[model samples]
Target chain A: MSLIEAPRTPTRGRRTGGINWEKWGWIYMRASGVVLVVLIFGHLLVNMFLGEGVKAIDFAFVGGKLSDPFWQVWDGLMLWLALIHGANGMRTIVNDYATNPKVRTVLLAGIAVSTIILIALGTLVITTFDPCPAGADPALLASFCEAL
Target chain B: MPEKSASNLVAEPQSPPKIRSPKRPAGTLYRGNEGMWSWVLHRITGVSIYFFLLVHILDTALVRVSPDAYNIVIDSYKTPLMGLAEIGLVAAIGFHAINGLRIILIDFWAFGAKHQRTLFWVVIGIWLVLLAGFIPRQLMHVFGG
Candidate 1:
């Protein structure tokens, strides 16, 4: 004769004692997603829908925005959050579809490398940006460039 | 008596095993309902947004190169074709954002799972309203000047 456990009895745990990276990753997606929605929407509204809309966008427009410390922080946060969020999402998709171990490894590596490089590059561009560069067409410069 | 017992212990002839198909054809959670469709659309839009983000970051990085370089590249975005593409990009982002919120609600809220079917339509309703406000404004910007 055998005895059965109660309905509410706890079962043996599947996960070993360690960090739960997957759980954190899952939480990161939703958290970053909420932030990115605000960041990216504000980005689009300012860059694409304001005043002259897309017509008003150019080097000058970007220079003007990037020159401002507020936008610098905005773009920087957007860059890190959105890139990591997207890279993680792509990792999930790749894990699902890429059946071959080698193929999956390669795809995952590509995502990781690209995300790192872009994040670094984007941060550099935002931090060290010069609104007005010398020997450039003065006509194309930001309006504030005239004051400078 | 021993020989008879040995003969009885012999195994029966074996047959080739047949592969058993699952009782459910599509998937466990996939019932062609709002849940399934919402999941599918979320993935599609997520992927599209990812690719666009990569390109967008590169374009913006051109600012560090030179004003001429950045302006010359960004100038192409004002073209009629790219203008239309912007609409699609915005649509994807809007859907992804709203639906992402819906997904969060389902995960955290007490009543969310029970009302998820309703939430999917709510996501669509909000997405449509956003696009309605955006499209006309964008069209005038794209085709106006």
Candidate 2:
């Protein structure tokens, strides 16, 4: 004979009747994980795997890329997506562990403020980057700039 | 039948009574569901971006150290493929930053359930507008303009 049986009334109460949020979190994790795999790997392949590999990396390498609009957009997308994905993931961890209401609120606020400041600064750098400034010392200028 | 002696009789062991532990109280506010998860992800991304910034700063500083080394680095950025990689980077930063703002508002519980979706879409709209302006500038520079 079976000992277990279903509840008679399904335990109707304030706690039992509410929204299910855990399901959505699980979904976001898997979704972000998939996208991250592509973005991260694609990033590595281009930076380290192509051409002369890691040795080819230098200041001009960055300047050359930043000079082009295509790279700027590419970098921009990666920046936004990865940052959001990472922040969201951390938020989940914080929610799970931070029990004290006041502490949790403070921590969350800190995260928000810092993320905003960084994103703004980073975007500015990418957009306003000047590879070869006119007044820059000749000694500091790249070979290409000297040619010009 | 002969009566059994006390020592000869076998005793049956009694089953232990089950003791149920008290259930923990469920968290308040949205019943601790999807919103909680979003909040968590927001923090994770925020930290990662911070570290990436550190590395980026060091790498760029090389330009000041040596022009030859800097040009070598800059040359790599010239490739078409590298251009695409950059797009990914921008998207990551933009999405994280905007969504992070949304999370901050949600924490205040000011918007309520009704306005959550509205706020989300508004953030998305802002991201799109910014991207539209940014992409063209990047392309023009890459193509040799």
Candidate 3:
């Protein structure tokens, strides 16, 4: 009779559960990174490169842009994407460095709270922004305000 | 060559035993399992945003410095092309914010791995809803409504 060696069993204390989370997170990073490259570069090119260049930026300029629906939508997208990306990125850092469970929890909570607050405030500013308010200090107000 | 005295044969008395150090198993800098890469990218983005914020604040402060200068800057924002630039900014902020929420949930709530797919879809849905509302409003402004 011939003897054969049996296959070795896996070591004890290995984590179990069917789902693979790390893989998915990695994929999310790459995918978001790709999209971010396009969005970020495009944003810089238009704001800094085009038109009269960097010197052309100002309140009336912003008011004028916001006055148009196109700019509003554009600004809105940038706000949403960058904020979420940043928040997600921080979450990753917290998970990696924060060893204590309680500490991790606190850190994560802080990130969430801050992100939500910023998003709410930013969106409000974009949607409710007034290019030309009534009865403002004439010197402080833009030309459009006076015209109104 | 003859048998040396016991004293001579004895190896020079070794230095008094120093405190023994504990053996430490090797630890990985990054977890080999899922999500490690994503976590790394998140940190990079967070730091980038901080830098961007400083610049943005300074630029906006220019308005307070000189209205004429501000108006010159503002006028540049008036073009149709500039409108598109704003779109890019909105997209960046939107994606970052929604993804950030996801990271928060996974870390704090102990959202199991199984639910990651669901959460991702939910984020996309929220983004779409916001975009829908924002786009039309922006277009109206551009068209001189």
DockQ of each: 0.65, 0.12, 0.12
- Model 3 chain A worst lDDT window (10 residues): A5-14
Off by over 4 Å in 2: A1-33, A137-148, B1-145
* Chain B TM-score of every predicted model: 0.80, 0.59, 0.61
Please provide, for model 1 over B48-123, each residue's C-alpha lDDT reduced to its tens digit, 9 standing for 90 to 100.
9999999999999999999888888899999999999999999999999999999999999978888999999999
Query: RMSD to the native, candidate 3?
Result: 16.4
lDDT of 2 by residue, B1-145 (tens): 3345443454545578997875975677655555555555456555556566545644554554455655656566657776665555565566666665565565556764457666767767987975775555555545543
TM-score of model 2 (first chain only): 0.69
User: What's the TM for model 1?
Assistant: 0.86
Q: Which residue runs of candidate 3 sit more than 4 Å off their true CA positions? A: A1-35, A137-147, B1-46, B50-145
Cα TM-score per model: 0.86, 0.45, 0.47
lDDT of 2 by residue, A28-73 (tens): 5455545654665565556644554444565556666777898888
Give the per-residue lDDT of model 3 (tens digit) for B55-78: 453444344345555565556655
lDDT for A52 in candidate 1 is 91
Ranking by lDDT: 1, 3, 2
Estimate, for each residue in A17-107, the C-alpha lDDT of model 1 and write its tens digit. Answer: 7999989999999999999999999999998888999999988988899889999999999999999999999999998899798999999
> Top DockQ: which candidate number?
1
Tell me the lDDT of candidate 2: 0.61
Which DockQ value does candidate 2 get? 0.12
